[model samples]
Structure formats: structure tokens, C-alpha cells
Target: MNNQQWTGWSSGAQQAEQHYLVEPRYLAGGGNLHHVADFLRASGWSDKSKTGGPLVFDSPDKSVRIGYDPYTQPGGWTISANPADGQEAWHATFTRQTPVEIVAGFTDALTRPRSAHAPNAWGPLQEQRWQTEQGQHFTAMSPDGGAWLQYHQSQPGQALWWAGARNEHGRIWDASFTASTPMHLIESFSAALADPQQVMRPRGHVPPSTRIRTTSVSVRPDELSAWQQARVTAARAATWARASWATTRPRHTTATGPHTQAGGRTRR
Candidate 1:
């Protein structure tokens, strides 16, 4: 069930369109560029964008690159880490449908430097009861089998990681991280994958091929949890802080004060 009022469409033509507000658990593929971009800017990344082209950012040391291009097929957002010697290191990409919060899980951990010891990539997913098979290869799938995360040995010393969702028809969207991708980064992605928060979608706008597998509820504004309410408050506060700072600071200034994750409190 969906609440028509929650659609937020004021135009008569838009109102006439059919939509259902669905809340998906595992395979919630969507993104918030503004949220992801803000986090990057705060992490000391520099923006190098043309007036009417793609959004691009470079790390402080020029070791990483992040881009958002509208015209790109399949995936619009790309992030890669490159070493100084010019050889490419690891990289991750996201289609427009991939949730930005999950992407943030990687970036946030990236900014906050951690110990060099490798963390288990499967730990977070295992906490959520996703089944895993470990051998010459590694694979994990959602309890319902709607989504999966896997690692494959691409070469003698190189490997690739991929995650995606599907239904009867075919694949929806997929994301990948190449070899040398930090284990902590992978762990962050796993934690986000196992998060309990559900993603909202318009029932009519959901993929035609996967619609039969969706699970939803009619959530009203009042139904949000206290923690979620606090996050909304923090987002409003951050927005206000950014606006006020813009008036007195340089154009490249980062917003100050309280910051909130894209959704509820991060599991990590």
C-alpha cells in the first residue's frame, strides 16, 4: 500500500500518474548525489567541474578520483584510487540506481583512516544472516536470494568484487570494486548492505522485471523512529549551516557543525 499524499507531486498531470510507495529491504537501489558530494567535499576532496558538464573531484593527494556524469551508460558515478606511479590501483563504480548511502559507507571509512590490519569482508553481511560460501572463491547472497555479493579471482594475484540484484527477467544494476580495494572499504560496503533501513520507491517506477519480488508498507511521517527523526533534524541543521557559511566563507569552504549519515545511524 502507498499513501498518495506522500507522492509529493503537485501537478495535475503528475497526480494522475499511478505510483506506489514501496519500502524495499535488501535490493534498494537508489542514490543521493548531493549527500555523497557533501561528504566528499568535507573529506578534503577538491572539485574540478566545468560549468555544464560532469561533476568531478580529486583527492587531496590526487590519489583518488570521483566523477558523476549524466550521459554515461549503466553507471553515472565512478570512483577510483590511483597510485603516484600512474598505474591504477582499485576502483568502485555505481549506477544511478545504486544507493549513495551504501557508497558513502565506503567513502566515510576511507576518510577516517583505520588500522592497516585487514578486516573480514564477510563479517558484516554474516551479521545479517546472509549465507556465504568460501573456497577458491567467495559468494554471499541475501536471505531471500534477491541480491548477491561475490569475489572472484581474476588473475593469479588479482581479484574482483561484484554485487548486484535480479529477478526472473535479468540483472537490474551492479557495482564492482577491483583488486587492491582496501578491506576496510569492502567491510564498510558490507555493513551498509546489511543495514536494516528500507529504501523508498514509487511502485510504478520500480523495475518492471523485478516488481513481483518487492515488499512494501505504507509508512507515514509519524512512523519514523526516534533515531531517524534525529537524523532528519541533523540534516536540516547541516543545510542551514552550509547556507550561513556560504555567506561569509569562500566558495570552496566546507560546511561546519553537525553532520548526519545519509540514513539512520551507521552500524559501524
Candidate 2:
């Protein structure tokens, strides 16, 4: 291990605040970890150097140089990014937002300007407990399909780590690493009290209210029941009400009452 202190990025010694292009952590291959590198390869950039150099992702203009070397760290890799040339060369670490954050950080670095828009504070949308090659794994995603987080353990009640990813639309994405968490398969169910399916689910038939329609209430004259009479009267009233509502657009109106039958009997 290089005993040299890795003081990430500091503006100055007085009130020095360290910033990182990509925060370094114990290598945990997360996200499409090599996406940036893949982009480089597609751009006709080759990783084959005559002198066997560190893995590097450089912009076409050769401004941004993100280099990673596994031998630099004792049990991991060292990822660093800087500009090859320019007065603003010192702005190497300004990419604090889109820094490569996986155990696969020995990967690519992007130079796209970070979005000025604020990131959404995500709440869990979906969860699944499944078995993986390693052990039992759990995963959760956001409702918008914009973020994903996962956890895995070696055995039934063993420890695990979190790996996460968030994206800005389809372009830039981020990974997650939460340390100092003591959760079992799921130690405590203490949660924020929280928290595609293009399949069309069958819904009960709903009669449209705003849409005017004709409803036939057929009944035999000799065997008319109170309910049948009520339906026939209601159908006629509805027809009239719809006409009145459509033509006059009445501000206030009462639904006309049902007719009363003979012998002081009310039509139900």
C-alpha cells in the first residue's frame, strides 16, 4: 500500500475542502461499470499502448485524461483524472457529479457537463428477494425507473454491501456505496415507513356519466314491478336531464322526483 496520503481534491490549504471527480472506494463492480470505456472503444480509441500504460479514457480533443492503475493500490486500484493541456487544466476534479464509482472504477471517465438541475430524492419503488450465485440478493428501484440499488450476502444472516445507480435521462449515470451499515438479510424492517407492467388489467365495466347514452328498460305492461317502473321512469328522466345539461348548461338544477303510484304508495 502506498503510505502516501490520498488527499483527493482541495481548493487550498486554508479551509481546504476536498472535491473528487469520482469518489474512490473499495472496488465493487457496480453499474454498467465499463460503459465509459466502451464508449471510448466505439470512438476508435484503442487501449493498446506500446509501453503498456495504465487504463485511460481520454476525450477526442485529448483534454480529459482519466487513468486507472491496479498496481498503484495495495489490494485495489487508483483512479485519477486530469486535463492533458490548458489553463483550466486544474479543473480535473470538477466532475464530482459523474465520477466513476464502482469497484470497476478502473474504467472510463466522462467529460459531459453536469446538469444544473437538482437530483431527485428517490424513494423505493420495487423490491425483490432472490437467490444469486453469491447468495441471497435484494434489489430496489425508483418509480421513475431512473435509479436502482441492490444488496447481496454470502449466506443466510451474513453481512452485505449496497450498490446503486441513478441516471439523468439516458446519458449520465451514478453508482452508490453506503458504508457503516449493519443490516442482516434485513436486520430491522425499519424503513421510511415506505416503500413496466404494460399489461392491460381487466377493469369492471364503468358507465360513462358525461357521455349521454340511451338505456332501454324493457318491461311487460301486465307484469310491471315497482323496480321495473322505477327503471323506465329513470331512463326517461336521464334522457331529459342530459338534453337539458347539454343545451342549456344549467347553473343549478334538481333531478326531477319519481312519480307516485295510486293508493298513497310511492314508486321506489
By summed lDDT, the worst window of 10 consecutive residues in model 2 runs over: 193-202
Give one digit per residue, the lDDT tens place, for model 1 in 68-151.
887767646788887656455888886776666677777666655565777988988888899998877799988768677899
**How many Å off is the CA of 9 in candidate 1?**
20
- In candidate 1 the C-alpha lDDT for residue 12 amounts to 37
TM-score of 1: 0.66
Worst 10-residue lDDT window for candidate 1 reads 8-17
- Off by more than 4 A, model 2: 1-36, 43-53, 75-268
lDDT of 2: 0.31
Clashing pairs in 1: 20-203
Candidate 1 residue runs with Cα over 4 Å from true position? 2-26, 84-88, 115-118, 201-268
RMSD (Cα, Å) for all candidates, in order, is 10.8, 31.6
Provide the overall lDDT of each model, using Cα atoms, as 2-decimal numbers: 0.67, 0.31
